[model samples]
Each structure stands twice: as C-alpha cells, then as structure tokens.
Target: MIIGIPQSRAFKWSYRAYVTLFFIYLALPLATVCAFAFNDSVFPSLPWEGFTWDWFFGTEAPYIGVFHESPILRSLVTSGVVAFWVSVLAVFVGTCNAFLFVRHEFRGKAILYVLMLLPLIIPGIILGISILVFSSSVANFLEDATGLWFDGLRPGLILVVLGQFSFITTFATLVISARLQKFDPSLEEAALNLGATHWGAVREVTLPFLYPAMAAAGVVAVLMSFENFNTTLMLVGSDAPLTITMYDRLKLGSTPVLNAVSLLLIVVSALLGLVSLLLQKRKD
Candidate 1:
C-alpha cells in the first residue's frame, strides 16, 4: 500500500513537471521577443543591453515608435481594410453557400460541394498562382472578345480579396453549415404551416438560431484574412499588407522595430481573446 501511494505521488509530480516544461518551451521564445523589444540595441538579438522605450515610444527620427512609423502604419491600415472587407464578403457568401448546401438538394450537388471544398485542400501558393493566372487569362480574353477593358483585373486589392476569399469562405461555410445541419427542419415546416412565408420563416426562425455559429465563423474569417501571407504575397501590389511589409523588412535586415510590432500584436491578440472569452461566458 505504501509503495502504491509513493508511485501515485511520483506519477502526479512527473505529470506536473512535464506540463511546466512544455509551457516553458512554448513561452520562452515569445518572452525573449517581448524582452528584446525594449532592449536599447538596434538589433533584436541581445547582449543584455540596457532597457529603453525607443522601440515602442521613441519620439525622434531613427527611434520612431510603431505608431509613428509611417510605412508600418500604412501597411497596418492596409491589412485592416483587407481583413474587414474579406470578413464581410466571406460571411455573406459563405452563409449563402451554407444555406444552399445544407437546406437544399439539387442535381450535381455532390460535385459542386467538392469543387467548393477543393480550395481548402489546395496549397496556398498554388492557389495564389492559379488565381493570378486565371484572372489574367480571363482579363485578356474579355479584352480580345469584347474589346471592353476591365480595369480592376490587375494584381491588387481586388485580386487579394478574391484570393483570400477562395479559402476563407470555405472555412466559414463549413462552420455555418455544420451548425445549420443540426437544426430541425420541422421548425421551418411549422412556421410555414402557420402564416410565415419562406423568407419570413428563415429570417425569424433559422437565422436567430444560426447567429452564434455565424458570429464565430466571422471571427475566424477575419483572423485568417489578417494573418494570410502566402496568397497575399502573390496578390498584393504597391499597397502591401502587414505580413508582406514585415517580410520585406525582415529580408532587408530586421531591427528591434519588428520585435516592437510583434509585442503590440501579441498584446492586442490577447485582449481580443480575453474579450471574446468574456462575451462567450456572458452568453453562456
């Protein structure tokens, strides 16, 4: 009995130790990055340089903060705009697709559904290339056939939006459709038997129930759009997104400024997560 008790205690201690080490492994790099953001050194790597707020809050020329860095700030604004529009468009299209796939059955439905989901499995790089090539071909064909110029066909914000939407909308559709499938068809039938029209029944009954799923899907869409790099790299033009801008800076030669940007993003992401958790808890 004494041996068994000791063995159990040893197992518990070992489990806790493993968990602690795992967390430390995950957090060490992030902690290092945050620490170096405030380091007085120009480079992000450190030899224990004295602390300074130059990276985050410097008011002077070379030591400009993230908010004061015009190029980074512009890139951030571009990212925000792209993410916002992507989320809105993805949600609208994906919700419609969910309804189409889940609520109705038609000929070639299986093939169409497979085609829609194909984007999810395709590599981002390949998908980006395909989109660019197809767009260019279509643009050329239209010019040759109709002789009418489609000015928005070039590699720019429109192309980026379309490229990101290809996969993001698929993700949203899967989320909303999963929730939609769980809904009972009898509710709609009951509403129809009463005085409700089809649109009215959908708006009044199914939509309210689907709100939570749609909200979650929208959040996912926005986050994915904001962080997407591979597809955006191909589609972005002179006006670059945050990820592309960061990549360019890294290639040129990284500075503590990158660390500062990382820190701000980490804090903002944490706050967003906390707010989302609180909202979910309140809803529960």
Candidate 2:
C-alpha cells in the first residue's frame, strides 16, 4: 500500500493522467524515430511503409545503409574520439576541482565556485561564439606577434573538445564534489597515520570512494560531448562530428537512414545509462 497521505479519487486520477501524458510526450518522438528506422520508404515520415532492413543493411545506391554510409561512419568515429578525450579531461580536472573545493580552504572560494558554474548558465550558442571569437583573436595575435602559427588555437577538434569541456567539467565537478562531501576525513587520516603518504592515502582510500562518481561524471561528459551541436559547430574545422553531420543531412532532407542513426544512438545511450545505474547500485 502507499505510505503517503491519502488523496481524493479526482486528485489520484489527475496525477496519474499527468504522469502518463508526460511520458507519452517524451517517448512518442523516440518511438516514431525508431519505427521509421525500419520503414522501407525513403522518407522518415509518412504512413507506415512496409518494414525492411534497407535503412540499416541495404547496399544499393539510394538505399545505402548506415554501415556503408562513409560520412556517417567517419563522423561517428570523430564524435567518439572527441567524446573520449572530453570525458578524460573533464573527469581529471573535475576531480582536481572537487578536491580543491572540498579539502581545502582558500580565499575567494565562493567566487571561484560561482565562476565555475558560469558556463552552465551561459547558453551553448553564446558560449560557442565566445570561444570562437576569443580563439580566433588569440590565434591572430600570436601569429602577428611571434611569427609562429599554432593550429591548435584555431577552430578545430581541439577547440570543440575545449568548448564542450568548459561546461561539461562543471557537471563532473558537481557530481564528484557531492560524493567527496560525504567522505569522512578520518579515513584518509587513518591511512596517513599508518605511514601512507598523502598521495597514497588518497590513492588507497579517497580515490576508491570517488571511482563511482568519476565514472558517472565521465559518462555524462561523454554524452554531452557526443551530442553537443552549437559549440561543436562553431569550433569544428575540417572534420565534423556525428551531430554536425546529422544536422547537415537533415538540412538537405529527412531520410530513414538518419532515423537509423538515431536508433543506434538511442540504443547506445540507453546502454550507457543502464551501465551507469548498475555501477551506482553496486557502489551503494
């Protein structure tokens, strides 16, 4: 039986209706996309065309599936690479920030924390434009002053990673920091008292406690980076990521192949989320 306060029949029915509608709103589009992924029709939308594997496995010209779609495959690889690096760097820096904010007292700590959160408050498009302009300015200045050009300072994958990292790191820091706050200092102290160095104490005690949080943060970073569009669009150079490529393709027209790609992404994202939940449960 329910343990909460009693509710009227009308209240109960309304609440249930609200929840059902909310879920339908969220799931209907995804369900539609998944449905079209198997549709034999060239377009992603319409009356249910007869189901076929052409969108995923066909090898012919107009029916070329995702497996043979060179652009999508290459962009997928590029997105994966960018996500990997963004996750690594974001987790690393976020861990450091967590430690700094939680373990030590410092001047202007509140200000620094607010600054760290500024990126989250900023719109993605604004953030992207800001980074693009700033990087371009810096690159131009360096070339003019030093006569040495740095390609990394230009709009490229590196900038995309950095642009994504700017906000994603904040999320990582928040997750790890919440975990760190719950950790007892005595555990580290006890390790230190037993002749372990500070680093050793952290490695043996604190890091173990933080592993789950870091993993979660890494997953968040990877997802955010992989799906990022505005920032990635601004900083992207010759190579494009999956989201950018999909956007370009959508601009031309909607096809079942894109629905196929979306289906694959949905599957992958669900798997990642499931793994994260399992890890969290195991940790608990």
Candidate 3:
C-alpha cells in the first residue's frame, strides 16, 4: 500500500518535535545536575553510589556536607553581602539616571546617555581591571600625599561591588528607562498642578509607579552579582565569592558538594521567581 502525503500535518508534527527536543535539550542537563546532588558518590558524575544527604548536612569525615564546609560557606556569605549591596546601590543610582534621562533634556543629554551605556558595551574583565587599576592608583596617590594608608580602597568586597555595579547599574538603568518610557508624563504634570512640589510629585506619584520595575532590576542585580565570575575573579582579594570558590574547587577536583551548592542555588532562585510572580499577580 502507498501512503498519502499530508504536508501540513507533517509540518505541524515536525514543529512540535523540534520544540520538544529543544526544551528537553535545555532541561536534561539541569535535571541531571539536580539528581547528582543526591547521589552518594565522592564525585558528582555518573554511577550513583546511593541516595544520601551527606553532601548537604554531613559533619563527618569524607562525606562532610556543604554546611560544614567553612570556605564555601564563607564565600557564600561574601556573595550574599556583595549581592545585597550591589542590588541596593544599583537600583538607587540607576533609578536616578533613568529619571534624569527620561525627564530632562540638558545640553549634553545625548552625550551623557551614550556615556551611561558605555559600561554595558564594555567587557566585564576590562571593567574589573580598570577599576582595580584606578583604585590602586588613587590609594598610592593618597598614601604619597597624605602619608596615610587606606586598604579599604584595595581589591576586596568594595572593589567587587564597584566592579559589578559599573555594568549592573547600566543594566538597571536600561530596565527602569524602558518602564519609564511607558509612563504617562501628564500624571506628573497633573500632580504638579495640584500644588505638589517637584520632589513631592516624584516621591509620591512617580516612584510608586516605578516600584515594580525597580524591584525587577534589583533582582537582576542580585543574581548577576552573585553569579559574576569574570570581573569578580579579577577584583576579589583574599576572601572570594561563591563563584570564585566553586571555580577553585573545580580546578582542584570535582565533588558532590558542588552539586549540592548548585541544587541549593536552584531552589533559592525558584523561590525568588515564585515570590516575584505572586507580587506581579497581586499588582495586576
């Protein structure tokens, strides 16, 4: 028997197959990683020994869990602190820049706008190196001139925050500016006509409208700062962030603890995403 050609049906089936394969390809590795987190193996790779929580909470010999791991825990703390500060600072500065760029047209408005975006165009490594060099030069100058040493400006968490901020804030500015573009200018004008001062209008009317966008930008800043490796690696001093610690550990050897950390991160990220969705739903 000869089969009849069904071109349209075949095309639809082919399209669905492609999409299914695409998603499976993306999800399979992550699924494997999560599964490996529970595997009771010295190594994170295949041939699972058994299911165990040794990697997550063990305080004993070879199976010492991530919680008992001091260096990794310390690096995790550093990542959190840096991410928190970076999120706060980036949102504040980026919101200010977004308002300035959207609301005003000064003499150098176009030039300043381009300058603000330069950070996004630049590579992270270059930004990190530039910041490190600039800070070192300033520290040296201050020491030579004032004869007072200041290690605060050196390569450390502060430098890491600054380095991440250099690009992250640009990201935030773009987000806030996009949201600001959709805003109706007349509302602010109406507030002004109703006897509200410029600052009052901005504080009460404008910022409330921008809260969702700012929150989203803040989330992006935290995630970026937490996972940042290239710039962070260059700027980090004696104390490293989670990404740096993970990299160092991989360089030495692989372990199930790494998988445990990855699993924890995935869980935290999922929780954050759920919270964001709930907030957005309420707003809607």
Arrange candidates, best lDDT first.
2, 3, 1
Q: Model 2, stretches more than 4 Å misplaced?
A: 1-11, 281-284
Indicate the worst ten consecutive residues by lDDT in candidate 1.
275-284
In candidate 3, position 251 carries an lDDT of 95
Question: Would you list the C-alpha lDDT of every candidate in the order shown?
Answer: 0.86, 0.92, 0.89
lDDT of 2 by residue, 1-284 (tens): 76788889999999999999999999999999999999888888788879899888889978989999999999999999999999999999999999999989999999998999999899998899999999999999999999998899898999999999999999999989988998999999999999999999999999999999899889888888988998898899989999999999999997799999999999999888777666555544
lDDT of 3: 0.89
As for TM-score, the candidate ahead, 1 or 3, is 3
Ranking by TM-score: 2, 3, 1
Could you say which candidate leads in TM-score? Answer: 2
Segments of candidate 1 deviating more than 4 angstroms: 1-16, 145-149, 271-284
For residue 197, model 2's alpha carbon misses the true position, in angstroms, by 1.1
Give the alpha carbon lDDT tens digit for every residue of 178-260 in model 1. 87888899999899999899999999999987787777777777778878999998888889999899999999887788999
- In order of appearance, the predictions have TM-scores of 0.87, 0.94, 0.91
Residue 227, candidate 3: Cα error in Å is: 0.7
Clashing pairs in 1: none
